[model samples]
Target: MRTLAVTTMDPRHRVLCRIRIEGAEEAEKICLLMGSEVAPRRQFIAAGATELDEARIDI
Candidate 1:
């Protein structure tokens, strides 16, 4: 089950990066691949049909 997630800042919640992943479990790996530190204050959002359209990540 592939999904899309966006890592964001802590207080501002500004989107730092976006990625298309394999599953919910891949969220952490994606963060690391993007160079997140020991405990990066970020966020992850899975993509549904609508979200895919919005984010425009090629499947």
Candidate 2:
């Protein structure tokens, strides 16, 4: 499998949630599950700078 990502950020560009997936659909689903909107469609070419929304209880 490959990696895709979805994220949410506050107006200040602070990370709210970041998650991994195999494709775009999963990314959106993750954001929904977290009650957030997906960040600008992004590239997850590598796990360079991703962090899960710290406010989330799942992590």
Go through the candidates in order and give each one's C-alpha lDDT.
0.47, 0.45
- In terms of lDDT, the best-performing candidate is 1
The parts of candidate 1 lying over 4 Å away from their true place are 1-22, 36-59
- Clash number for each model: 0, 2
Per-residue alpha-carbon lDDT of model 2 for 1-59, expressed as tens digits? Answer: 32233322334434655554556686764445344444432333223246655576442
List TM-scores for all candidates, in order.
0.19, 0.21
Residue-wise C-alpha lDDT for candidate 1, range 1-59, written one tens digit per residue = 53243334353435554545555566765546467454433433332334546455534
What is the Cα-based lDDT of residue 34 in candidate 2?
49
